[model samples]
Target: MRDEYYGRLLVQRYQLLEIAGKGSMGQVYQAKDTLLGGVIVAVNFLSRSKMNQRVRDRFMREATISALLGEKSIHIVKVRDYGVDEEEMPFYVMEYLKGDSLKEAMQNQPMPLPKFFSFMRQICLGLQCAHDGIEIDGNVTQVVHRDIKPSNIIIIKDATLGELVKVLDFGIALLKSDESPTGFMGTPAYCSPEQMDGKALDNRADIYSLGIMMFQMLTAELPLKPKTSSFDGWFQSHHYQKPKLFSEVRAKLDLPQALMDIVNRCMAKTAEQRPNSVTEVLKVLEQIEQNSAPLTTQSQSYTANTPPTVEAICLQSIWPKDKPRAEIVFPQLIQYRETEIATMWIMLSRSDIEKYRNNKPHSQFLFVGSPHPMLLWLTTLYQDEQQHRMLPCYLDLKKPIGEKILQILNQTGSYRLILFALEGDERCVCTIEGKVPTRKMQLLKEWLLESQNTGANHGQIKESKRSLKEELDTLKPKLVASLQRQISKKH
Candidate 1:
C-alpha cells in the first residue's frame, strides 16, 4: 500500500522519513512525530485493504501487549499510539532504533563473548515481558513469542555501545488461557512442532524458537536444512529429525561450554525436554555470564537439564506423545448487545436475591467511568443503596461495550441493579424487552423526563420505540401505544 498522512485535522508527531520495513499487515516507517518536536519514532501503518478481522485484531493486540512491557532491559518496541487516519487506515506509533537483523550482527563480526551473552540475556528479558503482561482488563495474559529467528531480532547500533538487542514480532504471538483461539500463527522455520501441527501451544513454543535462535547464534548454522523448497517440508523435519549439535557449527563459531550447555537444553525435540521456561533459560544464561572461568574442547558436552519450578506446570502439556493444541479454548458466550445486558441483569438479580436470603447487606464497588455526571450518578447510586448493590463496570473486554456490560453483570451477579446513564443518542432502553422490570422502567422514564423536562411525562398512549427522537414531548403516546401492542400481542 502507498503511504498516507495524519489521522485527524491536527498535525501528528513524527515527520515521515521513509519506509523502513514492512510486515504482512503493516509497513514500518522511519518517521518524525512533528508534534513531539522531531523525536524519531517508528510508524507502523496497516492499509485498509489488508485489514480483515484477523489482521485488525492482530494490529490492535500489538498495542495491548506492548503496554504491558515497559521494562528497560527488555528489547520490546514501545507503542506510542494506535489510530486511524481520515481515510480509516490503521496505524501504530512506536519507538525507532537504528539496527540490522541479528543475522546481520552475527554475520558482520564475531561478537565478543560478553556481548554475545548479553544479547542472549536481553532476548530472554523481552520474551519474559510477552510471557507476563497485565492485560487491558486488569488480567495478566502471558505472551509467547513463537517466532524468534535472527531476522526478527534487531541489533540496535548505539553511538556509545556496540549493539543492543530488541526482540520484535509479537503480533502473531498467542496470549495464554484465551478461549477458542482462531488458529495457528507464526513463521514456519522458527515455529515449534506444536505450532506447526495446529495443536495447542503455550510459552514452550517460544522456548523452542529461542532454542533454534540460540543454536544459530552460537553455531552459525541451522540444526536442520530441508532439501525441498516447501515450508511444510521444512517444518516436517522438526518433528522427525534430531537436531545437529552446536558442535556441527563450531567450525563457523565457537561458544564457551556454559553457554553451549544452555543452548542444548533449548534445542530439545519435545517442549518438556526444552528449558522449562524463559526464566529457567535466564538462570542458565546467568551461570554462563558469571563464570569467568573457561571451558576446554572436551568440556563442550552440553546436557539437557532444565530446572523444574512452577514453570514445569506449563511444560506438562508436552508430556503426552500426541501434539497439543495451538492456542487457548476460552468459554463460549453468546454475542448480542441488549440481550447480553438482560442476561447479566438476570444473573445479578438471582445473586442479589441469594445474598438477601443469606443475610449479608454491606459491600462496596468502585465504579469507573470517564468523568461525566452520568458516571457520577452511577457511583453515587453504588454508595447510597444498601442491602442491594449497584456498580458501573471498569474491566476492558474483547467484546463490544453493551456486551461487556452484560459480562460484568453476569460475572458479578450480586448487583441489585447496575445503573447505565446514556450520553447523546445511543439509547439502550428501547432495545431491551420484557426482561426489564416495569418498576425500574417507570422510575427510569420519570428520571429521564425530569432530567430533560419532557417526553413520556406528558402522558399519551400511541406507539413504538424510536432510534432517534426529535422531541421528548413526542414519546408518551408512543410509549402507551407500545405497551398496548405488547399486551394485545400477548393476549
Candidate 2:
C-alpha cells in the first residue's frame, strides 16, 4: 500500500489487486477481484514498519470480526477477505466508499441545519445499528463507532440517495475498549470521558461524540476548548465544569432548549447519567424539532427504534459445539484453524478412546491426497493446535493408495471408518481390503463438491434465513394492522 497509495497496484493475486488512499489510519488500497470481474473493493492495510505483532494480529482479527459481522447488503462498507501479502504484511478487503469523507464535504459542500441533521441522523441510525445489532455469530457484537468524527463519516453521492448517509470506518476505529491494553479509545477532541479513560464504555460514548459533532457542525467550533491534548502531556478534561451551552455559543442561533438539553446531556459527565438510550435521544431531538420551526428534511421513514431483523444462525445462534468430541488418532491436515483441526483430531482421538463404545462403531476416514496447500496448512494446524499424536498420514489417493487404505481399515475392522480423499472419486476407486462405502462415499463426495462449488453450508443456510427474516419483517407491521382491524370489528 505504500508505493501504490491511490492508483498503483502494490500486490497482485489470482483475482485480487491493491491500490491506496489517504486516511486516518494511513493509506488505504482499493483491491480488485479480477476473477469476479468488475467487482472492485477497497483494502485497508496497516503499513509495514509501523505494524508490530499485536497491531498486526488485531488488524487481521478485525477483518475476521468484520467478516463475521455478516451484515451483508447493508449500506455500510462491506469487509470481504483477510490475508497476508507476499511480504507477509497483513491486509483485508472491503467495499470501496465511492465518495470522500464528511470532512471533505464540510469544506466543499456545506448544508443548512435541517439538511445536515438529516445526514447526521442517518449516521446516528448506523450507530444505533452497532448498539442493538445482531451479527453472523447470532450474538450481539455491539459496534460502537469509537471514532465518529466528520472525517470518518461519509455522505456518498450514490445511485441510491436513501443509502447516502453512511458511517465509514466500520471496523478498527473505536476498538480501544477495556478488552485491550491500549485504553486510549479514539481521537482526543471527539472521544468521550469513559472512552478516554478506558472505562467499560458502550453506545453512550458514541452519543457523547455525536453531541460534540452536532455542536461543531452548527457552531464551526468544537464544544470544548481546542485541545492539543497529546501536547497537554496526556489526559484531557471532559467539559464538566459549566461548559458554555449551545445557546451561549451562538446566541442568535439559540438552539431550542430541548435540543440544547439533549446535546448537554449527551456530553454528560457520567455515562450512566446520560440519556436513557440513543432511541431516547432521538425522541428528544424529534420533540425539539416539533416545538421549533420545521427543519429542511425531517425524515420519518427510518427512526432509531425501528426494529431489526435478528437472525438465528449468527454466531450467537448456538454456543460452540466444542464439548469434547470423539477422539480418534489420525494424521492431521495443515492450513486449518484450531477448531477445524480439532474436529478431525478429536474425532480420531475419540475413535481410539471409544474403540468399542458402541456395537456399530463410528467411521475411520482415509485421508488420501497430493497435499493441496489448504490440506497442508490444515495438517500443520492440526499438529500445532490439537497437539495430537505426531504421526500424520500424507498419501496420494492413487490406485495403490486406495488399496493401502483398504488394507488398514480391513485389518482393524474399522470399515465404519470415514474416508477423506482429496480426489474423492474414480481417481482412487474403493479397492479396499473388504467392502467399500460406495453409497456413503458418494454422499460424502457430493457434500464436499457442494462446499467447494457453493460455499460453507452454514453460510448458505444463513443467507436463506436472512432472506426469510427480511420477508417476515416486511409483513410484521401489515399483520399487526390486520389483527388490529379484526379486533376493532369484533369490539
Choose the strongest candidate by lDDT.
1
For candidate 2, lDDT tens digit of each residue in 328-439? Answer: 2232111111101111222333333233222222232322121110111011111112222221222222112223333333333322222222222211111111133455
Residue-level lDDT tens digits of model 1 in 1-491: 23454232223445666778875467777777665446577778785677788688888887667645733223676676778766677778777878788888888444667666768877786787677655657676777766778888888764212355788766776677667555667777777787888777778888888888777766567777776747778677877877786666565565667677777677677788887778788877765554542422212332245322211211111111121222111111221211222221111333333443333222212221211101011211111123333322222121122223333343433223211122211111111111333444444334333322222111111111121122323543444454445545756
TM-score of each: 0.56, 0.54
Q: Model 1 misses residue 110 by how many Å?
A: 5.8
Which stretch of 10 consecutive residues in model 1 shows the poorest summed lDDT?
Answer: 372-381
